[model samples]
Target: MRAPALSALDIHLFQEGTHSRLHDKLGAHALPAGGVRFAVWAPNAAQVRVIGDWNFWAEGDAMTPRTDGSGIWEADCPQAAPGQAYKYRIVTPSGELLEKADPFAFQSELAPATASRIWAGTHTWADDAWMRARATRNALDAPMAIYEVHAGSWQRENGEFLGYRELAHRLAHYVKDLGFTHVELMPVTEHPFYGSWGYQTTGYFAPTARYGNPEDLMYFVDHLHQQGIGVILDWVPSHFPTDPHGLARFDGTHLYEHADPRQGFHPEWNSAIFNYGRHEVRSFLLSSALYWLDRFHIDGLRVDAVASMLYLDYARGPGQWIPNAHGGRENLEAVHFLQALNRAVYREQPGAFTVAEESTAWPRVSRPTEMGGLGFGMKWNMGWMHDTLRYLREAPVHRRWHHHQLTFSLVYAFTENFVLPLSHDEVVHGKGSLIHKMAGDAWQQFANLRALFGFMWAHPGKKLLFMGGEFGQRREWTHDGELEWWVTGLPGHRGLQQLMRRLNRVLTEEPALHAFDFGPEGFEWIEADDAERSVFAFLRKGPPGTAPILAVSNFTPVPRENHRVGVPLAGAWQELINTDAGEFDGAGWGNLGGARTVPVPSHGRAHSLVLTLPPLSTIYLKGPTRATNA
Candidate 1:
């Protein structure tokens, strides 16, 4: 069999650095006529050969370079079949022989073994209905409760990792039962070290073989989609590990990364950063992003460590980094690369979105690219998470001093389409678990946690809670071990889990809580300056014709009887959820199911309800409807 040649257009686009579908041309593709066609980009290589088990690991199958000066080598291996491990044998300009894995491999050998496997996509997709309806399901106005999970440690069988096929059913059923709209997986892409948690990626196009094969990962996404659950993958483009068999020093030069350490090396992570100024590198990353959405049916990508990519001086001291042409801290090349990546993703995969895990206050991160922004669908709200946790850590007596921590988030809440993330980062690295972060006795701690969840759900943004937080895991998160699944057996922990389920339910069922999450129209402050009593009251409103829902929270342990809270309408208000209710392991102190508003004015409203506010609890009320009050 003769090697299949790349088309004229393929070569042109690849050299021009605009090829978003390079996977179709490069990598090992199974030719229908006979065997496999292997292609790789090694412009500086003196010679390249295809060596694998089929050829007894010999150097006979030499690849021919393209005549168009594109520097891509191609070869035909009639003997190469699926499942066989293979690698590239490149002779560099310095006469150095380098054994490198194919950069565009669809499947890779399990870590500790460095080789790429010949894989032809064989998974049959059954998600047409989901693909068709996802536009509405993933709309900006729709309720989005993301459950962030680390696949390797989410669950285990006999102290071993469960394959993707097994994890798919278990994770899907669990997320669906908890009412989460999507599952955000912590990077499942292949990495050399399990300790890195897939952040030090080596295989851009392959799922980590530790969990399962390429087909198994596809089944994971397919199963989630079939169960009405969207899948979001954590994508790392900021830096990669300096593994010799990886992308570093390919063809005996910095082919994928910058040659200068000042510009290429990531000081904080001790990894190599890609040269975003290189057009070919941009095409490689863009193709990788599209491959997952196109082949695996993934709903979205949550880009990790975007803050490091945006600023040149990130994690660097003075004179340790290079600046842009304007002598600013920003990396203009990275900015352009990010804009192109986002534009390509949105254009190629309709309804699929991208999120940024950016900690800095970069303006308009979630805005459109045309509007002079980075163009992400949503951004993680690090400020809100930090403020809320800091406030919760203070003792109740001192909470009054930190009142701004709770209310300050609302000052800039609508600046971007935000996702209130209580992510794995908060529960690791000696930060302790969410339950342990609260400052009080056991009962008060649980109550504070419950109140925090209530406040988060009622706040104006999408919600994302890490895996073990729902059940109140007592220990810090560990990538080496599974979550504390047994904690759910305890009453307080079980009650917390129950509250999470109810919170997700309310977030989905109530339009007022989700419809305008990105705008100020959805939220109105009823009473934001109750610092003396450590209390807050707010109203979440929907579009016209929808009734408003009220949220009131008390941070202190002392209950407030006859607490006067204003309401928008003069009628009956039903207590939809009370974190202090006995069902959630709290003292049964609340308005007896509902409250009727009096004509007395309060908080600039025409009517008010004099009700009992429970200690360390948040309650949501909905009412003033014709069916209930008229």
Candidate 2:
């Protein structure tokens, strides 16, 4: 290793937490003299030493601390080289000795091992075209149907996991064929426990080695970009697991987390909460976010459990949690940190954005920071998911009494940019599959599931569906096993899969469904109060001149013949999709391919059409573009 070399300004910025790329200056950096320079931040350490394979895991020389008292130590060794396993041995101020892995390591040995590996290779990317046009492709007005996946459980070969390169081809082709615009991966960062589903992150800088090397994961993102599919990584900033080698206690103190247990310890997950008020800790998280976007070319980040970070008393009862300085439950420091994080992310990677998994009615989460908001691009609509699921799980006969649950979400749907997510969370923890959530026999369950997908696609929001949801998998999701791939061969499951493909095709091809997802002007209710019949009908409009598409749903198993519904214009209307058609294992009921509007006034409209309402299904009809009989 060589001697520490940094300007006074670099030290000041790092100390003040303004340095966004601390990885470049810290960790094991290559030296020009055919050696390596290593540095670590251990403020409470009396002395720090570099212990690695080069020194046979023995400490050779003590690293020099910054004279300015920045608490940083550095050294250069001629014996150190790339691919060497290394760690820092620190002598704390209390004279206690401890060894820890590098916090900014770009690579690490696979699990059952905790040593950091020296890596310096950079990946070459061929996705300039995708990068340039990403803004337009990810615009709020454009179509975005995401398929959420857990990498390790997405598929297994011979009961063994597939590498990133192999899964890249497999996952990309599958997503493209399904007509999805993006794939939201569950956390892929390194964590020791396989059951955490990558949420208990230990290596913020390293991609998990269970899949492949860092470059191989880069290839996965690049290949997906080439296929016109954006990739969104699930990022956890709420808290981290208290693994010994992680950021729990460094330098014999709680440097990264809170020193106070009331504020630091997370009771629900048995993890440690980050001290967002600390400058160094905030800089650490900001740098980690940038590292993934800069090195891996990720399109976006789905911030997990943001509500947990915004509240001091989250999941805690009275007297169990400490109040903020203002005597309120709000965590002001974390709010500021999140605002800064969003600002930095958009500034560094233009066109890339973030999503918040905030479950509360926190106002303006997706609004811009300058507008006094959290500044996320969109938010997962947990309210919609919960309310709709609750309503669907009830028996059809009881739906009328609880009909408002289905319509209540529209009242606040446009308050923030929303993504209607039927995510992995819904299918896990004994919740059963989406289809199983429906209350009915085999035939009605399939119909209800298809109807749910049709309604969700037509709703005023972006879309996200978890893996195995396209085809109806009856079992709950488990990290140890792959999805029931054999179920797709079954007739009912295959039909549901086909219905999903068609729904995605129509959602993308028809601008009326996506153009104004965030504004009320895009949606018009023709008959939302028909709770007695458990039926709903609405019109989805595009820009001012474009035609509208009419959607009608029946929650009951009894089909309605000659069901009169309002139409905007008197002309031919094409049947775009029918969830109850025989192809999707439905009762082969539909409007003989098209319907015509009559002069008879109905449902507050000048023109109307008598339609066949299929049992427990939804049908989408495209109205004529030309105006007639105003």
Candidate 3:
């Protein structure tokens, strides 16, 4: 929890007293007329000040020292009573100027929309009853077949943007009927331009006006929650893009960023990174993390680009970035910010999750904060998706990919809490639609997707399918366009959507599908290779008795009769769901099988299974059932 070795430049400002300074001086930041009481923890500053547009960028001497003798700055300003604009300006011993976002402000107004109106986000969450009884960290019991969507492109009409409320009803039906347990929207915060896809966000507090206002987002989340669907927002605190009209140069300078370019800009993203080195910045970012969890009742944060946040020069290629002040290649400020964000969010909302979309080997994303980890509840399994998809696309003949490509996830599937994301990025910018990624024509494309999804369900992780992938979008996604809803005329598309819904519902019923959501106990590899026939078989474990749903997939076109993959000797397995069940317009590759024990050879001993797997399809075979196939 200590700051990195401060450079002569980093310690430009230093102060003392961790708790009392801001609390006592700012009246404990008590909210007047039903407002929020704000407080920040900055254990390394001599003096702290509040600044913002409403205050006209004037640094107030209001930042007093904390009484805890921990060097934390204290300020409980009453400025948010009517929801005015604000920021932070602190002076270090060396007289450097640092401007950071309000550590506890519920909303941040972007530079273009600097003047903010902060109303208390007080509402009657009748679902509070549900929230209280909600299972903690139970991605399995929680029904999490999330639909990854970018709000801006999800829908639009007549040059008028679709507000949050509009999206709630529309997307609700789409996702609900699609059988997804949740809807995950990309970052909605106020950002510049529609190009960055909200990744290069500048305003940490404001809801992006491109969609609608703050309440609109809250209403959207509320509606989704009411529909028994969880809402997860993509949050970006790892870095902020350099947009002159946004936070990059607010108050006539890059005050929110580091003064030196070495510690300021991210060359790969062309953005300005935060100085996590500053205590005020830490408070600002942590408070933003708490704001979403507290006010919006958001189930989780799908933290974007964590790799960029954790590394100083990630994706920098050759000479695109500068070294940190500590002579290390990593952005330590970002590391601490993520840690603090997790700590604050967990402390404030125990079950609230912080998920990172990180693609690196930075360990412990799901580890406890006290253990020198990033403290995320889950991290996206990017390696799994990339390698799996590549294997799918390159192996048109099913023999090109090595056995490792098909079964490599077992090496790290249980490494941390992971969610398998077939994100929007994969379907756009010439990447082609998820269906188009298949090697065949339209029908085969849909079948390939069906096969892929069957594999996804069988894999040991929570699932996320992009918006259009469900309905068989053939072309890449476009922001200015609607998801070819017109394509419903095509059978390939309809079948895909139907399969998605069926899979989602079935996933909920079968615990084995998502039991590996958090811990290692949920998943086990039943069979890694059937390489002789280009097929793979695995088992998913949920809560016991509820455990053991055999996932059998045939990657090749040549049908294999009596495809006897060894399943656990737990009991008789039932053919629960088949991807090729004609319902999805597949070849109907499954045969009605009851739990009839059959011995099969494997890596070591004779493994036994009571299931029949068909070619180029997926079947969720539930454990030992006395019932026979109808």
On lDDT, the leading prediction is: 1
Residue range with the least summed lDDT across 10 consecutive positions in model 1: 621-630
Ranking by TM-score: 1, 2, 3
Supply the global lDDT for candidate 1.
0.91
Candidate 3 residues 1-630, lDDT tens each? 322222223233222111111212221233444432334344444456665544566655376554545344544454545456555565545655656554334455543554333445445565665466444433434557788888877778765568888988999888878778778888887666677777777656667766666777888888888777788889887678764334554433454677666567776677787877766556556656666777778888888888877877676655656777877788876777678677767777867787899998888888888887888888889999898788767545754345578788877777787889899878877888887677666556666778889889777778888888887877688877677888876766777777877788888876666655565666666667656666677666666566477777777666677656665554566777787777777777676655555566643436665444555677777775313221
Error of 3 at 418 (Å): 0.9
Assess every candidate by TM-score. 0.98, 0.97, 0.81
Prediction 3 TM-score vs. true: 0.81
- Worst 10-residue lDDT window, candidate 3: 16-25
List where candidate 3 sits over 4 angstroms from the true fold.
1-122, 135-142, 249-254, 317-327, 398-400, 517-521, 570-572, 593-595, 599-613, 625-630
Candidate 1: tens digits of C-alpha lDDT, residues 183-231? 9999999899998989999999999999989999999999999999999
Deviation of model 2 at 203, angstroms:
0.9
Clashing pairs for model 1 are none
The C-alpha lDDT values of all candidates are 0.91, 0.89, 0.67
Clash numbers, per candidate: 0, 5, 26
